[model samples]
Target: VKPTTPRGQLPLLKIDGKQYTQSLAMQRYAAKKAGFYPTDDIDALVCDECCDTLEEFLLKFPFAAKDEEEKKAKRAEFVKGPMTEISKFIEQKIQDAGGKGFVASGPSVADIMLMVNVKSVESGFMDYINTDFYTNYPGITAVTTAMKEHPKVKAYYDSLN
Candidate 1:
């Protein structure tokens, strides 16, 4: 998402702009640009659900206990089950939309959204998550593999340190 002049388009001139202040707003614009806007009201509801699910898990990640003995056994359960299930279900929906492996006839914002979402899980979900969850749903995975190879995405990921 571009931070812009007050007109919201330009050779962007705003420094310390609202766009710089709002990560959520930036991501929404990016998702929209990629064509991932929800298709219908129900899908919109689904999108919100998925977003909430991720935030809930993230809320606990920063404080996640460092050792098996350091954290209660149950403290980590909710994050894993719900987060993993939602991702798997969403992956199913992409397939159900069409098995050919795209959310629409061509690439859409949903592909990018899912790619980033799944990558977060790969980094955060400490348990042994087999990428096979994606294999059965190759459409979603294809987008992910391509995104991983993309120059910009690859650069951003490499800069994660």
Candidate 2:
């Protein structure tokens, strides 16, 4: 096999001999299979809220800063304030969604997606995850812990080492 930068094409997923390109499509399929998507109307709304926040953060903070002082300043200014507030907003949504649990009746694509970035921060990729970022949110912490222990997720993370 020829090697190339990560900019090269990603491997394809073929199902029933049909290929899917877009990641969202694949994620939706996985969500359906995983049964994490909401079954009720209101819960579905809540799920979208969770997904939206997770997606927003990825776009906002693409990676940890290599500039340590700058990262700390950014964390203190933007992250602890706006970013922390966003997390609380998501938590509030989850709390508002009644006893549905985890913004949905069960774990969905949103869970896995949020888990990816949260785990990155929790696993030492960021300096602030442990320092009050998720301090008040037990649900988020539990979710991240579960994601960290997930068999497949653990394997994928392990393979990176």
Best by lDDT: 2
lDDT for model 2, please: 0.66
lDDT score, candidate 1: 0.55
Which residue window of length 10 is worst by lDDT in model 1? 12-21
Please report the candidate that would top TM-score against the real structure. Answer: 2
**Clash number by candidate, in order:** 5, 1
Task: Looking at model 2, report the run of 10 residues with the lowest lDDT sum.
Answer: 1-10
Assess each prediction's global lDDT (C-alpha) against the native: 0.55, 0.66
- Model 1 C-alpha lDDT per residue in residues 1-161, reported as the tens digit of each score: 34434545533323454423344456556666555556566655555554555455456443456886545454345446765565566667667656432434444444555677667656645443443445555665766787677665678679997
